[model samples]
Target chain A: MKVKQISVFLENKSGRLATVTRVLGDNGINIRALSIADTADFGILRLIVNDPDKAWQILKNNEFTVSETEIIAVQVPDKPGGLASILETLEKSKINIEYMYAFVGKSGENAVVVFRVEEIDRAITFLQENGIRLLTGKEVYTF
Target chain B: MWNREMETIPRPQLEKIQAERLRKTVERVYNNVPFYRRKLDAANIKPEDIQTVKDLERLPFTTKQDLRDNYPFGLFAVPREEVVRVHASSGTTGKMTVVGYTRNDIGTWSEVMARTLGCGNVTEKDIIQVAYGYGLFTGGLGAHYGAERVGAMVVPISGGNTKRQLQVMVDFNVTALACTPSYALYFTETAAEEGIDIRSLPLRVGFFGAEPWSHNMRKEIEEKMNIKAIDIYGLSEIIGPGVSSECLEQDGLHVWEDHFMVEIIDPNTGQVVPYGEKGELVFTCISKEALPLIRYRTRDISILYPDVCRCGRTHKRMNRVMGRTDDMLIIRGVNVFPSQIESVLLEIGETEPHYQLIVDREGNLDDLEIWVEVSEKIFSDEIKKMEELENKIKKEILSILGISARIKLVEPKTIARSEGKAKRVIDRRDVYTK
Candidate 1:
């Protein structure tokens, strides 16, 4: 499923992130979700965008390094044990979660959760084979 | 260590092998490369007369300009179809000069480079991270092929993106790196700024080349990176990064005499000086197939040592090059020459010949301040002429050379009076090092 996640190379410098974001704005690419994985010398900025290929193209053209990947986006009713149930299913399947993000749907009811799993295809297959509902690109993006 | 083909050859046998190769290379260049033949013809020397290594001096000297005039592949000894690879000097900033290699030439290059890396205790077990730029620039591919030939896992992380370079080093467990000394130093400094203790890194040795550096600066690098900083020397005009290298002894860089011949000659008298005497370094590529250069003037000032090393290798060694004899400067490890800046000014058509190259080492790096003469042609007396001239020269010089230069508009005749070969370079790095 399509996920709105941002991946950026994290340079520890404060303004370096700004340079990447400024580039997105200048090129008119909007960031839907963003997080950073960091080491001392660099950090990977993970991002899901409105235009994945164009966002990547804009960054690469400006000499900004970018890596693209697919992930699983699951929608759940905003109730108790919502995150716990998804976690138990992924945990049982032995799928490692590198990073994940959660947000409320614009309609203000269903919960949208994005996960950058270690094994993407297998993660989706396990969820599909287990009767867990997954969000499509249009559903995740529009919500 | 397994490929002991040329390195393990006995000294006397190596000499004989070189002599045979030298004579053939002389004859081959005379027959195939018209440029070398014309140069030999003008000097009244026949290729047949040069039978021994001693007779090599009798041939005329080849120079950088010769490479430029015979631009691209004119100097190649073989047909274009036989050539497997081409590497060029960024003579892109000057008149471009190119060099080519056959399959055999590339093998010899890799062997010599492996030997250079071997000097630093590198082996097949080490992962080599190549940070030098690839493509036409020889620094990247030169190091890349050699590391691969030596059986090391290589990271072809060509220059730029400091963050990615650091991440790759950590993520891949890269143990060695190759780049311009300047950039490597910059990487170390950037790492520190980010709270990265350099001692925590995996890099153990760095092969820095394509620029001039000092022993004192070498100490600084060794301290900063907590790794051995090995100096590797090469120019695209003369093979690539395998030309010569300094072993752990750090006494002098050992030149691969089996493939190339080395001589130091007095520039004024054009006479070969005895061993240990300082003079311009020259080379004759005895084993090069695509371009067998003969007595090519490197314009680098250095001396050679013929003694066998404690490391048990018998290859000849060259003292670390002091500096270039031409319009070259080592400001903070950057090769700054007047021609590079002059080209930019020429493109704009408002600069004059009167320019002083001012170089100094700051806090931890070298800085260049170009004191250029402001010609009235581009500036109207109505403006603050000096300020406008300063901005113009600064912008153009920075654009040409990625390094910034402090442009000071000195009034005509303000750059101290020089009588002889104009003292264009006033280096202040030496004082700071002391």
Candidate 2:
């Protein structure tokens, strides 16, 4: 139930984000879901890609500081209280979410939310016991 | 005219006094300090052989590494009881170059500092404000004692507290100021912001040292504060800020040859350079009682002129220090080395070993910004984690170096990889120009 995410360290300068996307696109690596965490001086570009290992290698070879992280993609109902209910479940179990971002899936009835939690295995087990669907690495990469 | 007899002693008479003092210091160190004893024995030289100041070259040169090897209290000629004070400055590593002073040694320091203030003709009627930081660094108490010895009312206001400094300067009618040249410039700006015209004040002279500054900076400070700026020079390894000072003429700083014997030598060849030529400065503390150094290499580059100054002081005058032979950087009167910063990063084990130190002057104070390349091993998807890494590096550097530096995390290949000696320091302060 773990998905590999590619995170690139981006300096707060013009065209850096564009350069990262261009590098991945030219190498045929499709970015499925992405979010940027920014500050006044720098930003972190977190990405879920079709081929994470390939994207990581390409970014590293291109002189960008990149790393691989493990996150979970959960299929939540496409409704207002969908994320709130999952968050409430995790909060009851005391599993801390470091960061989270959402993306609309091809199936209009559901949405995929990427969560980076502190206790990955415990979070996966607790969420599964609560009858929530967790997308595997292969399923998320292919989708 | 503090100690006018020694300051104006004839060249021949000064040389005789130096020879006599040199002989005594060599004998004292050889007998008391085991480190110097081993050094002298390894060189196959005896105390009796060093008859005059010219024989100083026969002795082995003492480097900062030697000081570190001895650690604390290893180089003092006097016993622990006789040593009354100790002052230390940061070394290139975690260890510090420690120095001790005896009662007589403190008296000697006061005498030289008095001469330093006397260069500006500071008298008892003048109220001197000693702005140099007063702890182990020696600038504070060194100037304080000298001003008191001159019978001047001393305001022992240590460094920092800018507004308080200005208030004391005005309320006390300070006539002389002693501090770093950069701080003097900073005071001018602060005075203007507070709408206090410093030119209209009674502040007349400033003794600036503990860092290398340019002639242009002197002109700027003099113009801004309407004060005669004099350059003073010294190190904790020697007797703090009293080794030499520029007279009112402002031509060159006069080295007190009667107390400290000065020499200029080719840094690579170790051969004595001709007079008026630039070389590494080396001093042998001839009159010091506690921490007597024999041919201690200062690593500062400058020239020595035997010509007597027009100020009637026969002591040999040396030009302002041009640069250092090593990569040590002085930021706001504190010693900083690139290797020290490297050691700090290595200990943290968070960032890559590749880094660069950028020293720049912002509004009359030195600012150090460190550019460290982020490594993939420590990079995180969470921005807070990355910020924590930067803060950890900054805190470690501050704890080790005693100065706060802005840690800038850049991309992996942002710092250029060099095949030769890596360029580690980028000094944009422009304070070292002649």
Interface RMSD of each: 22.3, 0.9
Misplaced by over 4 Å in model 2 are: B350-352
lDDT of 1 by residue, B193-275 (tens): 77666667878999988877767767878898888999998877779888998887777887888988888998777789998
lDDT of 2 by residue, B236-317 (tens): 9989999999999998899989999999999999988999999999999999998999888999999999998899999998
lDDT of 2 by residue, A11-128 (tens): 9999999999999999999988999998888899999999999999999899898989999999889998988998888899898899999998777788899999999999999999
For A72-141, candidate 1 gives per-residue lDDT tens digits of: 8998779999988989999999988867777786677888788877788899989988889998876765
